[model samples]
Target: MKVMRILLGYTLLCSQLCFGQSKLHFIVFADTHDRSLGQTNLKTFHDLSSSIGFVNTIATYAGLQPNLLLYEGEKCNPKEIDQLLTTLVVGKDDVIFFYFIGHGWNNRQNNYPSFIFGNAYTDRATLETISRNQYDIYRRLISKQARLTIVIGEACNKERSDSPPVISKREIEIMSPQPYDPLKIKALFRNWSGGFLLSSCQRNQFSYSDLKGGWMSVAWQNTFTELCNDTYKRKVDWQLFLTSVQSKTQKTAEKNEQKQMPQFELSILPFNGSTPVSNIIPKSNTPVSITNAPCPSIDSYVNETALAGIREDLPLLHEMYDEIDSDNAKEYAGAFGLFFQNQRNFYNKLGSMVFYEATGIPDKCRPTFDKNTKWVFDSTNEIYQRISVINKYTSNPNKLVQQARSDLPSIISRLEEILEKFDK
Candidate 1:
């Protein structure tokens, strides 16, 4: 009965939206906790993807077609994540859209590693690590004859508090607008549209919940849907959603994520604090007024409040060299190095964003920090090779490099120094 009421309300809302706001078109799929699409799971994810404003934005408000409500009917897969993200990028301008939900995984090798319904398993890395490249996917979507683009990623960020590393957002910019490489899927997970990537946790942290008897990430699951369905129909602010999710997740821990404590985080790019984008939308040629963009470094954004996000999240540049020292970890180090190198590029682009915002948009919208993204494929590639070798070997033979890590000062200082140099 309740579901019917909600669906009915959505139909009514869609009717009104025909002449209402043309800003956002959100296509959501939620409760995707599964290895396959069973009838039960299908029902859950189907409702989730739509109940939230995600469905309303795409269908009711924006009124677009082929706009999907669910993919494979609960057969969550990497491509499903890609599909909604790509579709939202279509025709998006000025309005903000969201992909919010929870997921889980278990790695006896290293506590709970975050899970995508269907993705190649990654080491217990941060979401920003994943998102650094996903930006390219959004880039491809926006390039398709759209005036402006904005993305909101509210996926749960799961890291261990004891682990001390969590997810952080990186600046991703595409040199070209057109899709560069579909085969090169690395860029697909990055969030480079210069918009927001607000996950539930930082890099290596955990996201838990206790709503509806242990749904994937209930904090967002319970409230987000109803809020977006509001008669007021106001799009919920990212920060506001985070604040609410945190409180709700904690309360529902007995039932959500099937754990006692839940950790959630909200991050933003060009975040001015105190409620982001509060009823404000930037329009084409209207000039995006920005401040402290291109943050001299991550610390620029990591003050007391930002610290709450940072401390819980991953240390910016630290641990980047972890794979470098271990001969075994070296082959994989290329990917890890890629993580930091990508961040460096992002940091530069952020500064460039500031410069662009202060000055007028660049002649071609090029950010100043574009030069930093170059990676010496040879050196890093060599390390990447070693990483593979290490993984193959029984034990790591690169003790000499690993031992030198003791001399690199503290991880915090090293990370701080890296942040400072980028500002310089």
Candidate 2:
């Protein structure tokens, strides 16, 4: 009888442990690039500025104790980034990985569309020191049997100021080869899973950041921190999690005056919507297509365009417009556009509301800094810069993916449903 009781107790304990475990697991990397090449020295790159602070911020927010991280030139070998992935090759679970900083590629070559690790310094032994392999990370993630996965990149293959005036004819195609002989190559996803990837800049563009105190990437890191750390609650789905991240990130950036953009890809299967987002938990699997902006992308576009090639994005702007019916889309365009044109008046009302909402100090939160009140606006320099980059569609600078501020009314109406659903 005692043995039977003991066995039952053990089983119950195991069940509860599983219940409490977050569904998300992810690895993050920041400022990884030619550690040897820079206007800023290695010392600058190594500091724990706002960039790294944001990284740690998100880790804390997600209740995530990052298993491993590769920063700058230290743990940047392609192979080193992937070693941990080998252990997870068979686990069909959603995992998140982030990479930010500089990127280098054989720009002259038309071979595989792969970029070089930014540690442009040619020190082989230092490079070969074993760590995790990025390839294994990709493999474990792309496995269909894997749960779900998300990979976000905040690097540009080349500097935006240096990119050609033309967007590359090539599509951002990183889809792993179709399942051929799963018996041989076990990493691709067609057989079992889902995921997405978000990149700061496009194929021909460069992603850049104005380091806070000349250390680390700030804008990119802030967005991740706000989304994953502050706003995330348990039970939220990936789409909403992404939406919140994109929105709050901009707000955080704006407050700090950091300018840079952030982008991402999400998976359809793992994207949970149709209801207002209330919470978030960690995930496991692949990536997906993104949904609407946390705040409309129009405001960000206005500020972004004024900043030269330092454009940004908030997911695919066109896709957000496409979410509603055609009639609604047209209506939204006109209304949203008009509101932005008269933003001065709108700002006054929003500012007052925010003041009353705080019921405390004048400087505790910026207008947009209030995470609890969604109606008021969030306007800070860092938010604007982050939005500018994400809203820039850095991948296709020539293309205008945002609804001009002049077209916001209709856009807001179109968003009415989603917003109301969120209120519920």
Candidate 3:
């Protein structure tokens, strides 16, 4: 009996020691070809091939295998890109990463920045029309699905000159009708939360590509890879990853006698503190599905406050559960009393918070939260009932503790599954 009790205590302790984490889904694509509907005068980028290689390598290392890797000839028009991103369903806990490496230019009329997709627009006027409205559309599409949307645009927003420059000039004369301010383009995402826009260079500054691939692409690839190797066992710090990419790419641009400093904006609010991407585990070998789930309709936009709260609280709850169960036989009576009191307090607090949020939900989204409230009430009741049954086994206090410890895992697993719905 003593040996079995010790084993149960060890199992409970191990559960408390375990870490809680989640994964991110990444999509990487590049527009390197110049089709212009079969125009022979188009200029194709040979350097973009390296962009593909870097995305694949980093995606593999990070365990966020790309859901879509659109290369040359892939449909990248504003409507098509928007349609593709809109198809995926993102959860509040998940993040979406969209990376583009190709030609970008400011409209000759209004200076709005736009990325050129393969064969999308033939004339300058057509490209300008698409560029004018595409930024807001893209930002909203990506932002709606996930908790965070990260965009990495490694392209130059300059005039389409008769001849592209060999080296970027530090100071270029302002040309009206073309927007040269990177900050202006970045401002499009100012109102959104959990958005990070990383542009390869400031407005008017040019991004370079060579046989080695894009300078920005190479820098980010190296940064993600090195973090994996350096951390070995620890989770990679997302902030550090972003900083390293900026630093390395800046160095490369300086070496080429260019002042192509990368510009970025990040607006994610951390739940507790800094958020880290966990290391890729063995189970992450499978790739994420590219096919979109059924698009969520109007009532599907559920608030994730309670779900996020539960996820954040689980680690601490596990610790408390384990500690209360570890008391020796002599201390069992007192420990059980304290455990019951704490359990009631914790659940009441969490349950009431969830109920309050559910009741106050606006009319349009009431269905989703109403369902979630019932789920919470039912699950908590089951937990309370299980604990009560365990407490009734007063004749064999050790057996009571063992049964409760054995049952807690399934209850926790059920709660986790419930939380995962908010992500999908």
Candidate 4:
């Protein structure tokens, strides 16, 4: 009995140690103190923090342990980053996700951007002391040889350009309300093994952002949310996932009348001496018919509830625009206040509506739905651009407001036309 007890104790200890070594490590590094892009950087950190929490929850559901470390604000400096990289310890089976968002510029020497860790951009000494290339960071992390390493830098890559580039929703409300599939989550975080690098924009391009968040970061989060919520996909295709993120990022940039093309490099290492291409590619491309799919309900909701909601709000928008265009300052102030509040809700609703239409609707309606959704997104982005301009307060506020007001009528008309087509 004593010998049997000893054997059992050894077995449990081995199991515990093995589990600890295979844990996932998620690290976020963000410079949230830059004078120009401070607020946008902070928003990105909050959004990503929420995303990390979601990942932790899913990891726990899959019976895996995840460790998260956040270095932001004043703590996000070069010394700390280097120290962390130098002293970090990783396991062979561990997964590492490192993300950095801040003001960055390319030197025309390396493909990656150099992060400006110092907030005092005017101080040449400070800038030189704090700036670090993302390629160096990637190399140090990959040298640890964890099962998988993902390095993402979401910042402008413009060479010698002056422009500085830049979530949680109601927490659980924005994520899929349904129960998550543990196996799928495991497949995504655990099954894959490789080093993946992502940049928000290509060479000589400026990554764009607004008061909400960086367009690239928003697109990345949205794509991940959709993938996590999709329980019907037979396999998690990392290649497709990256492609979708790239496409969404570009589309969002174009909608805002800007240009940003995200670039990514993915290398899937061999598993057990077998090729990793099979793992990267899904076994099939056909969409799986989800059991008890919400297609019909979504169709009805989009055609009835969503469109009616927009129609009801259009009159108020027009009224606010009239008041803003009026000569009275008091009326303009009140109208601007109402416009800000209403536009936020309206934008959020349109975003949710488009997500549902894209994911839940049947294939037959996809063509028309795609066209309508594009129009809606593009118009909303136009309004968003005006809002951003007014919010910046860097120029004459009244002139910007008037310009936005001037463009409102045509945008509203197009929205009304889209609504008519939807009704039909």
Q: TM-score for all predictions?
A: 0.42, 0.36, 0.44, 0.56
| Candidate 4 lDDT tens digits, 1-424 | 6995675456445544645557667788887877777787888888767654545654454344677788888888888888989988987777788888887775432456777765735544355557777766776787787777788898887643254543211111123444444555556666667677888988668877777677778777666667755355656567877887898888877766678898887777634423343244221112434555633332343434345545656786687666664355444554555455434444434545434324544676557666756766776566556555553432444664675576667657766865875664
Runs with alpha carbons beyond 4 Å of true place in candidate 3:
1-24, 35-66, 69-71, 108-112, 119-121, 130-138, 165-193, 231-236, 272-424
TM-score-based ranking, best first? 4, 3, 1, 2
Q: Provide the lDDT at 215 for model 3.
A: 68
In lDDT terms, how accurate is model 1?
0.36
**TM value for model 2:** 0.36
Candidate 4 TM-score, C-alpha based: 0.56
> What does candidate 3 score on TM?
0.44
What are the root-mean-square deviations of the candidates from the true structure over C-alphas? 13.8, 21.4, 27.7, 16.5
Q: Count residue pairs with overlapping backbones in model 3.
A: 3
Cα deviation of 323, candidate 1, in Å: 17
Give the lowest summed-lDDT range of ten residues in model 3: 277-286
